[model samples]
Target: MNHEDAEMELTADSIITQRVIARPRPHRPVQAGGKVGAVPDAPLFLHLDAVTTILDSLAREEPVEAGGLLVGHSCTDSSGPYLLITQAIPATLARGERLCLTFTHEAWNQMLDRKQKEYSEELIVGWYHTHPGLGVFLSGRDLFIHQHFFTDAMQVALVIDPADFTWGLFYWQNDELVAANGYYIYGRSDQTYQALAELLTEYGVSWGIQTEEVDYNA
Candidate 1:
Protein backbone atom coordinates (compact mmCIF):
# COMPACT_ATOMS: atom_id res chain seq x y z
CA MET A 1 0.00 0.00 0.00
CA ASN A 2 1.22 3.51 -0.69
CA HIS A 3 1.77 6.04 2.10
CA GLU A 4 -0.72 8.31 0.34
CA ASP A 5 -3.34 6.14 1.92
CA ALA A 6 -2.19 6.79 5.47
CA GLU A 7 -4.57 8.84 7.63
CA MET A 8 -3.90 12.54 7.88
CA GLU A 9 -0.90 12.82 10.20
CA LEU A 10 0.17 15.81 12.23
CA THR A 11 0.54 18.93 10.09
CA ALA A 12 4.29 19.30 10.09
CA ASP A 13 4.83 15.61 10.71
CA SER A 14 2.86 14.59 7.62
CA ILE A 15 5.27 16.32 5.26
CA ILE A 16 8.20 14.37 6.67
CA THR A 17 6.14 11.20 6.43
CA GLN A 18 5.31 11.82 2.76
CA ARG A 19 1.76 12.91 3.57
CA VAL A 20 1.95 16.57 2.68
CA ILE A 21 -0.70 18.87 4.17
CA ALA A 22 0.23 22.21 5.67
CA ARG A 23 3.28 24.31 6.40
CA PRO A 24 4.36 24.97 9.96
CA ARG A 25 3.20 28.21 11.52
CA PRO A 26 5.60 31.14 11.70
CA HIS A 27 7.93 30.63 14.61
CA ARG A 28 9.43 33.50 16.59
CA PRO A 29 12.01 35.55 14.75
CA VAL A 30 15.69 35.03 15.66
CA GLN A 31 18.95 36.82 15.01
CA ALA A 32 21.82 34.85 13.53
CA GLY A 33 24.63 36.27 11.38
CA GLY A 34 25.82 39.78 12.36
CA LYS A 35 24.78 42.05 9.54
CA VAL A 36 21.60 44.13 9.41
CA GLY A 37 19.33 45.51 6.63
CA ALA A 38 18.16 43.55 3.58
CA VAL A 39 20.88 40.95 3.39
CA PRO A 40 18.94 38.46 1.23
CA ASP A 41 21.86 36.06 0.85
CA ALA A 42 21.81 34.65 4.37
CA PRO A 43 23.03 31.08 4.79
CA LEU A 44 21.48 28.07 6.51
CA PHE A 45 22.14 27.70 10.24
CA LEU A 46 22.53 24.42 12.16
CA HIS A 47 22.47 24.32 15.92
CA LEU A 48 25.62 22.92 17.53
CA ASP A 49 23.60 20.27 19.33
CA ALA A 50 21.87 19.26 16.11
CA VAL A 51 25.14 18.79 14.25
CA THR A 52 26.50 16.53 16.99
CA THR A 53 23.31 14.50 17.03
CA ILE A 54 23.41 14.00 13.27
CA LEU A 55 27.10 13.10 13.31
CA ASP A 56 26.63 10.61 16.11
CA SER A 57 23.60 8.98 14.45
CA LEU A 58 25.22 8.66 11.02
CA ALA A 59 28.56 7.57 12.44
CA ARG A 60 27.01 4.85 14.59
CA GLU A 61 25.61 3.21 11.46
CA GLU A 62 29.11 3.06 9.93
CA PRO A 63 29.36 1.92 6.29
CA VAL A 64 25.61 1.79 5.68
CA GLU A 65 23.38 4.76 5.02
CA ALA A 66 21.39 6.14 7.95
CA GLY A 67 18.61 8.69 7.85
CA GLY A 68 16.51 10.95 10.08
CA LEU A 69 14.45 14.13 10.36
CA LEU A 70 15.60 17.68 11.11
CA VAL A 71 13.47 19.85 13.39
CA GLY A 72 13.73 23.65 13.52
CA HIS A 73 12.04 26.86 12.47
CA SER A 74 12.20 29.39 9.62
CA CYS A 75 12.51 32.98 10.63
CA THR A 76 13.34 36.25 8.95
CA ASP A 77 15.17 39.17 10.49
CA SER A 78 16.81 42.32 9.22
CA SER A 79 18.61 40.04 6.74
CA GLY A 80 15.64 38.30 5.12
CA PRO A 81 14.68 34.65 5.68
CA TYR A 82 16.80 31.68 6.81
CA LEU A 83 16.47 28.17 8.19
CA LEU A 84 17.62 27.04 11.61
CA ILE A 85 17.89 23.28 12.16
CA THR A 86 18.10 22.42 15.83
CA GLN A 87 17.44 18.68 16.09
CA ALA A 88 18.16 15.43 14.27
CA ILE A 89 15.86 12.54 15.15
CA PRO A 90 17.09 9.25 13.76
CA ALA A 91 14.86 6.90 11.74
CA THR A 92 15.71 3.69 13.49
CA LEU A 93 13.10 1.71 11.60
CA ALA A 94 14.06 2.90 8.13
CA ARG A 95 15.88 0.59 5.74
CA GLY A 96 19.37 1.79 4.87
CA GLU A 97 22.05 0.50 2.54
CA ARG A 98 25.47 1.50 1.30
CA LEU A 99 23.97 4.22 -0.86
CA CYS A 100 20.22 4.07 -0.40
CA LEU A 101 17.62 4.79 2.26
CA THR A 102 13.92 3.99 2.31
CA PHE A 103 11.67 5.65 4.83
CA THR A 104 9.32 2.87 5.66
CA HIS A 105 5.85 3.61 7.03
CA GLU A 106 6.87 2.48 10.50
CA ALA A 107 9.95 4.64 10.37
CA TRP A 108 8.09 7.80 9.44
CA ASN A 109 5.46 7.21 12.10
CA GLN A 110 8.08 6.72 14.78
CA MET A 111 9.95 9.88 13.78
CA LEU A 112 6.72 11.85 13.62
CA ASP A 113 5.65 10.64 17.03
CA ARG A 114 9.01 11.45 18.54
CA LYS A 115 9.06 14.94 17.10
CA GLN A 116 5.60 15.65 18.45
CA LYS A 117 6.54 14.47 21.91
CA GLU A 118 10.06 15.81 22.18
CA TYR A 119 10.32 18.89 20.02
CA SER A 120 6.75 20.12 20.15
CA GLU A 121 7.75 23.73 19.65
CA GLU A 122 9.82 23.24 16.53
CA LEU A 123 8.92 22.63 12.90
CA ILE A 124 10.07 19.78 10.69
CA VAL A 125 12.58 21.69 8.62
CA GLY A 126 13.84 18.78 6.51
CA TRP A 127 15.50 15.39 6.55
CA TYR A 128 19.10 14.14 6.70
CA HIS A 129 20.78 11.01 5.41
CA THR A 130 24.26 9.59 5.14
CA HIS A 131 26.12 8.53 1.99
CA PRO A 132 28.84 6.67 3.92
CA GLY A 133 31.72 7.01 1.45
CA LEU A 134 29.65 7.94 -1.59
CA GLY A 135 30.22 11.68 -1.03
CA VAL A 136 27.73 14.61 -0.89
CA PHE A 137 25.29 14.73 -3.75
CA LEU A 138 21.66 13.81 -4.14
CA SER A 139 20.73 11.17 -6.67
CA GLY A 140 17.55 11.10 -8.76
CA ARG A 141 15.68 9.21 -6.03
CA ASP A 142 16.85 11.70 -3.43
CA LEU A 143 15.47 14.60 -5.37
CA PHE A 144 12.22 12.76 -5.91
CA ILE A 145 11.83 12.21 -2.17
CA HIS A 146 12.35 15.88 -1.47
CA GLN A 147 10.02 17.05 -4.20
CA HIS A 148 7.13 14.68 -3.65
CA PHE A 149 7.27 14.48 0.14
CA PHE A 150 8.88 17.66 1.42
CA THR A 151 6.70 20.02 -0.59
CA ASP A 152 7.18 23.32 1.18
CA ALA A 153 9.55 25.47 -0.85
CA MET A 154 11.85 26.04 2.12
CA GLN A 155 12.06 22.43 3.29
CA VAL A 156 15.52 21.04 2.49
CA ALA A 157 17.52 17.82 2.44
CA LEU A 158 20.88 17.35 4.11
CA VAL A 159 23.38 14.84 2.73
CA ILE A 160 26.45 13.76 4.61
CA ASP A 161 29.45 11.54 3.96
CA PRO A 162 30.48 9.98 7.24
CA ALA A 163 33.76 8.58 5.95
CA ASP A 164 35.01 11.97 4.87
CA PHE A 165 33.17 14.16 7.38
CA THR A 166 31.77 16.16 4.50
CA TRP A 167 28.17 17.37 4.16
CA GLY A 168 25.97 19.64 2.06
CA LEU A 169 22.45 20.99 2.07
CA PHE A 170 20.05 20.47 -0.84
CA TYR A 171 17.27 23.05 -1.11
CA TRP A 172 14.66 24.09 -3.62
CA GLN A 173 15.93 26.77 -5.98
CA ASN A 174 13.17 27.94 -8.30
CA ASP A 175 11.93 24.66 -9.77
CA GLU A 176 15.11 22.71 -9.05
CA LEU A 177 16.87 21.18 -6.08
CA VAL A 178 20.42 22.44 -5.66
CA ALA A 179 23.26 22.23 -3.15
CA ALA A 180 23.58 25.16 -0.77
CA ASN A 181 26.84 27.09 -0.57
CA GLY A 182 27.41 26.69 3.22
CA TYR A 183 25.80 26.72 6.67
CA TYR A 184 26.50 27.82 10.23
CA ILE A 185 26.48 25.80 13.47
CA TYR A 186 25.48 27.93 16.44
CA GLY A 187 25.00 27.76 20.22
CA ARG A 188 25.30 29.82 23.39
CA SER A 189 28.74 31.37 23.11
CA ASP A 190 30.44 30.27 26.37
CA GLN A 191 29.27 26.83 27.54
CA THR A 192 28.05 25.85 24.12
CA TYR A 193 31.30 27.12 22.71
CA GLN A 194 33.35 25.07 25.16
CA ALA A 195 31.27 21.93 24.72
CA LEU A 196 31.43 22.17 20.94
CA ALA A 197 35.17 22.64 21.16
CA GLU A 198 35.49 19.39 23.11
CA LEU A 199 32.97 17.49 20.99
CA LEU A 200 34.68 18.43 17.76
CA THR A 201 38.24 18.70 18.95
CA GLU A 202 39.80 16.41 16.38
CA TYR A 203 38.05 18.27 13.57
CA GLY A 204 39.81 21.56 14.51
CA VAL A 205 36.52 23.35 15.20
CA SER A 206 37.01 26.68 16.92
CA TRP A 207 35.00 29.86 17.57
CA GLY A 208 35.77 33.11 19.33
CA ILE A 209 33.00 33.37 21.92
CA GLN A 210 32.63 36.66 23.72
CA THR A 211 29.35 37.62 25.41
CA GLU A 212 27.49 36.56 22.24
CA GLU A 213 28.66 35.80 18.72
CA VAL A 214 26.09 35.62 15.94
CA ASP A 215 27.66 36.08 12.49
CA TYR A 216 24.69 38.23 11.42
CA ASN A 217 23.17 39.83 14.52
CA ALA A 218 19.85 40.61 12.82
Candidate 2:
Protein backbone atom coordinates (compact mmCIF):
# COMPACT_ATOMS: atom_id res chain seq x y z
CA MET A 1 0.00 0.00 0.00
CA ASN A 2 2.99 2.25 -0.32
CA HIS A 3 4.16 4.26 -3.31
CA GLU A 4 7.11 1.94 -3.85
CA ASP A 5 4.84 -1.14 -3.82
CA ALA A 6 2.27 0.36 -6.18
CA GLU A 7 3.71 -0.82 -9.50
CA MET A 8 3.13 -4.51 -8.75
CA GLU A 9 -0.34 -4.97 -7.36
CA LEU A 10 -2.67 -7.94 -6.78
CA THR A 11 -5.30 -5.25 -6.99
CA ALA A 12 -8.94 -6.07 -6.16
CA ASP A 13 -8.75 -9.18 -8.31
CA SER A 14 -10.57 -11.74 -6.10
CA ILE A 15 -10.27 -13.32 -2.67
CA ILE A 16 -13.67 -15.04 -2.32
CA THR A 17 -11.91 -18.45 -2.47
CA GLN A 18 -14.02 -21.17 -0.87
CA ARG A 19 -16.16 -21.55 -3.98
CA VAL A 20 -13.56 -23.97 -5.40
CA ILE A 21 -11.73 -25.29 -2.34
CA ALA A 22 -10.66 -28.92 -2.26
CA ARG A 23 -12.21 -30.84 0.62
CA PRO A 24 -9.84 -33.61 1.66
CA ARG A 25 -11.09 -35.29 4.82
CA PRO A 26 -10.44 -37.65 7.72
CA HIS A 27 -9.06 -34.37 8.91
CA ARG A 28 -6.70 -33.67 11.77
CA PRO A 29 -6.32 -29.96 12.24
CA VAL A 30 -2.76 -28.59 12.47
CA GLN A 31 -3.62 -25.68 14.68
CA ALA A 32 -0.92 -23.08 15.21
CA GLY A 33 -3.06 -20.85 17.38
CA GLY A 34 -6.43 -20.83 19.11
CA LYS A 35 -8.12 -18.79 16.40
CA VAL A 36 -10.71 -20.25 13.99
CA GLY A 37 -8.95 -19.33 10.78
CA ALA A 38 -5.37 -19.48 9.47
CA VAL A 39 -2.79 -18.92 12.17
CA PRO A 40 0.74 -19.97 13.01
CA ASP A 41 1.17 -23.75 12.40
CA ALA A 42 -2.08 -23.86 10.40
CA PRO A 43 -2.46 -27.01 8.32
CA LEU A 44 -1.31 -26.86 4.70
CA PHE A 45 -2.58 -29.55 2.36
CA LEU A 46 -0.29 -29.98 -0.62
CA HIS A 47 -1.20 -32.07 -3.64
CA LEU A 48 1.27 -34.41 -5.30
CA ASP A 49 0.78 -32.61 -8.55
CA ALA A 50 1.88 -29.34 -6.98
CA VAL A 51 4.85 -30.96 -5.28
CA THR A 52 5.91 -32.51 -8.56
CA THR A 53 5.78 -29.16 -10.28
CA ILE A 54 7.78 -27.55 -7.52
CA LEU A 55 10.44 -30.24 -7.66
CA ASP A 56 10.80 -29.95 -11.40
CA SER A 57 11.08 -26.18 -11.28
CA LEU A 58 13.65 -26.28 -8.56
CA ALA A 59 15.77 -28.79 -10.42
CA ARG A 60 15.75 -26.84 -13.64
CA GLU A 61 16.91 -23.60 -12.00
CA GLU A 62 19.32 -24.88 -9.43
CA PRO A 63 22.11 -22.66 -7.94
CA VAL A 64 19.99 -19.57 -8.64
CA GLU A 65 16.90 -18.21 -6.97
CA ALA A 66 13.56 -18.94 -8.70
CA GLY A 67 9.93 -18.61 -7.75
CA GLY A 68 6.24 -18.75 -8.64
CA LEU A 69 2.71 -18.59 -7.26
CA LEU A 70 0.92 -21.32 -5.35
CA VAL A 71 -2.52 -21.92 -6.86
CA GLY A 72 -5.31 -23.41 -4.78
CA HIS A 73 -8.30 -22.69 -2.61
CA SER A 74 -8.17 -21.07 0.83
CA CYS A 75 -10.90 -22.59 2.97
CA THR A 76 -11.94 -22.75 6.62
CA ASP A 77 -13.82 -25.49 8.37
CA SER A 78 -14.59 -26.85 11.85
CA SER A 79 -10.85 -27.04 12.37
CA GLY A 80 -9.81 -23.73 10.84
CA PRO A 81 -8.52 -22.39 7.52
CA TYR A 82 -6.00 -24.49 5.56
CA LEU A 83 -4.32 -24.03 2.22
CA LEU A 84 -4.87 -26.81 -0.31
CA ILE A 85 -2.14 -26.33 -2.87
CA THR A 86 -3.35 -27.86 -6.10
CA GLN A 87 -0.84 -26.46 -8.53
CA ALA A 88 2.57 -24.80 -8.82
CA ILE A 89 3.21 -22.54 -11.76
CA PRO A 90 6.70 -21.19 -12.16
CA ALA A 91 7.48 -17.64 -13.24
CA THR A 92 9.42 -18.49 -16.36
CA LEU A 93 10.04 -14.85 -17.15
CA ALA A 94 11.34 -13.98 -13.71
CA ARG A 95 14.84 -12.62 -13.31
CA GLY A 96 17.14 -13.91 -10.60
CA GLU A 97 20.64 -14.33 -9.28
CA ARG A 98 22.15 -16.53 -6.56
CA LEU A 99 20.63 -14.45 -3.78
CA CYS A 100 17.81 -12.52 -5.44
CA LEU A 101 14.72 -13.31 -7.45
CA THR A 102 12.61 -10.61 -9.01
CA PHE A 103 9.06 -11.25 -10.11
CA THR A 104 8.90 -9.04 -13.14
CA HIS A 105 5.63 -7.58 -14.42
CA GLU A 106 5.72 -9.97 -17.36
CA ALA A 107 6.30 -12.92 -15.06
CA TRP A 108 3.53 -11.88 -12.72
CA ASN A 109 1.11 -11.24 -15.60
CA GLN A 110 1.93 -14.65 -17.07
CA MET A 111 1.01 -16.39 -13.83
CA LEU A 112 -2.26 -14.45 -13.54
CA ASP A 113 -3.15 -15.33 -17.11
CA ARG A 114 -2.54 -19.04 -16.51
CA LYS A 115 -4.51 -19.01 -13.30
CA GLN A 116 -7.46 -17.43 -15.06
CA LYS A 117 -7.35 -19.68 -18.11
CA GLU A 118 -6.39 -22.98 -16.49
CA TYR A 119 -7.30 -22.88 -12.81
CA SER A 120 -9.94 -20.21 -13.12
CA GLU A 121 -11.80 -21.14 -9.97
CA GLU A 122 -8.81 -21.49 -7.64
CA LEU A 123 -7.22 -18.71 -5.59
CA ILE A 124 -3.53 -17.93 -5.31
CA VAL A 125 -3.24 -19.08 -1.74
CA GLY A 126 0.46 -18.28 -1.47
CA TRP A 127 3.84 -18.37 -3.18
CA TYR A 128 7.07 -20.49 -3.19
CA HIS A 129 10.64 -19.46 -3.94
CA THR A 130 13.91 -21.35 -4.19
CA HIS A 131 17.03 -20.29 -2.30
CA PRO A 132 19.48 -22.59 -4.07
CA GLY A 133 22.36 -22.97 -1.60
CA LEU A 134 21.39 -20.12 0.69
CA GLY A 135 18.82 -22.16 2.69
CA VAL A 136 15.24 -21.49 3.95
CA PHE A 137 14.19 -18.15 5.36
CA LEU A 138 12.84 -15.07 3.68
CA SER A 139 15.09 -12.11 3.10
CA GLY A 140 13.97 -8.51 3.53
CA ARG A 141 13.08 -8.39 -0.18
CA ASP A 142 11.17 -11.65 0.06
CA LEU A 143 9.13 -10.32 2.95
CA PHE A 144 8.42 -7.12 1.06
CA ILE A 145 7.17 -9.08 -1.95
CA HIS A 146 4.92 -11.26 0.18
CA GLN A 147 3.59 -8.31 2.20
CA HIS A 148 2.75 -6.34 -0.89
CA PHE A 149 1.43 -8.97 -3.30
CA PHE A 150 0.16 -11.76 -1.07
CA THR A 151 -1.68 -9.54 1.42
CA ASP A 152 -4.31 -11.89 2.80
CA ALA A 153 -3.91 -13.25 6.33
CA MET A 154 -4.46 -16.78 5.03
CA GLN A 155 -1.73 -16.46 2.46
CA VAL A 156 1.60 -18.26 3.04
CA ALA A 157 5.26 -17.98 2.11
CA LEU A 158 7.22 -21.14 1.25
CA VAL A 159 10.99 -21.15 1.05
CA ILE A 160 12.89 -24.00 -0.60
CA ASP A 161 16.60 -24.78 -0.54
CA PRO A 162 17.34 -26.59 -3.77
CA ALA A 163 20.84 -27.43 -2.63
CA ASP A 164 19.72 -29.76 0.12
CA PHE A 165 16.19 -30.10 -1.23
CA THR A 166 14.86 -28.81 2.08
CA TRP A 167 11.81 -26.58 2.39
CA GLY A 168 9.77 -24.63 4.93
CA LEU A 169 6.38 -22.91 5.10
CA PHE A 170 5.78 -19.64 6.92
CA TYR A 171 2.53 -17.83 7.75
CA TRP A 172 1.37 -14.75 9.62
CA GLN A 173 0.89 -14.83 13.37
CA ASN A 174 -0.17 -11.51 14.85
CA ASP A 175 1.53 -9.84 11.87
CA GLU A 176 4.69 -11.92 12.40
CA LEU A 177 5.97 -14.82 10.32
CA VAL A 178 5.80 -18.21 12.03
CA ALA A 179 7.18 -21.49 10.67
CA ALA A 180 5.13 -24.68 10.59
CA ASN A 181 6.59 -27.78 12.20
CA GLY A 182 4.68 -30.11 9.90
CA TYR A 183 2.07 -30.27 7.15
CA TYR A 184 -0.22 -32.64 5.25
CA ILE A 185 0.16 -33.99 1.75
CA TYR A 186 -3.15 -34.94 0.18
CA GLY A 187 -3.57 -36.52 -3.18
CA ARG A 188 -5.26 -39.39 -5.04
CA SER A 189 -4.94 -42.79 -3.41
CA ASP A 190 -2.85 -44.04 -6.30
CA GLN A 191 -0.13 -41.40 -6.20
CA THR A 192 3.30 -42.36 -4.88
CA TYR A 193 5.51 -40.17 -2.71
CA GLN A 194 8.60 -42.33 -2.28
CA ALA A 195 10.94 -39.53 -3.32
CA LEU A 196 9.26 -36.85 -1.26
CA ALA A 197 9.03 -39.25 1.64
CA GLU A 198 12.79 -39.63 1.76
CA LEU A 199 13.32 -35.89 1.72
CA LEU A 200 10.79 -35.34 4.50
CA THR A 201 12.47 -37.98 6.61
CA GLU A 202 15.87 -36.48 6.01
CA TYR A 203 14.67 -33.08 7.15
CA GLY A 204 12.64 -34.43 10.09
CA VAL A 205 9.50 -32.83 8.76
CA SER A 206 6.23 -34.48 9.70
CA TRP A 207 3.38 -35.03 7.21
CA GLY A 208 -0.01 -36.74 7.07
CA ILE A 209 -3.06 -37.73 5.04
CA GLN A 210 -6.77 -38.00 5.82
CA THR A 211 -8.14 -40.79 3.63
CA GLU A 212 -11.61 -40.77 5.13
CA GLU A 213 -14.18 -37.99 4.94
CA VAL A 214 -14.98 -35.80 7.90
CA ASP A 215 -18.50 -35.41 9.23
CA TYR A 216 -18.54 -31.88 10.55
CA ASN A 217 -22.19 -31.95 11.65
CA ALA A 218 -21.82 -35.21 13.57
Most accurate candidate by lDDT = 2
Displacement of the residue 105 alpha carbon in candidate 2, Å: 1.1
Model 1 scores what on Cα lDDT?
0.66
Off by over 4 Å in 1: 1-13, 16-42, 189-199, 203-218
Q: Can you tell me which runs of candidate 2 are displaced by over 4 Å?
A: 1-9, 14-40, 190-218
Candidate 2, residues 143-207, lDDT tens digits: the string is 88777767777788888877766677888778887777645654565434454455444434332
Per-candidate TM-scores read: 0.75, 0.75
What tens-digit string does per-residue lDDT give for candidate 1 at 1-218? 12452234435445542222233222222222223322224357777677778767765635888888898877665545667787899988877876688777788789889988998877788899988888889988787777767778778898877776777778888878877655556664454544544555445332221223333443
Whole-model lDDT values for every prediction: 0.66, 0.66
Model 1: ten consecutive residues of lowest lDDT = 25-34
RMSD vs true structure, all candidates: 6.5, 6.1
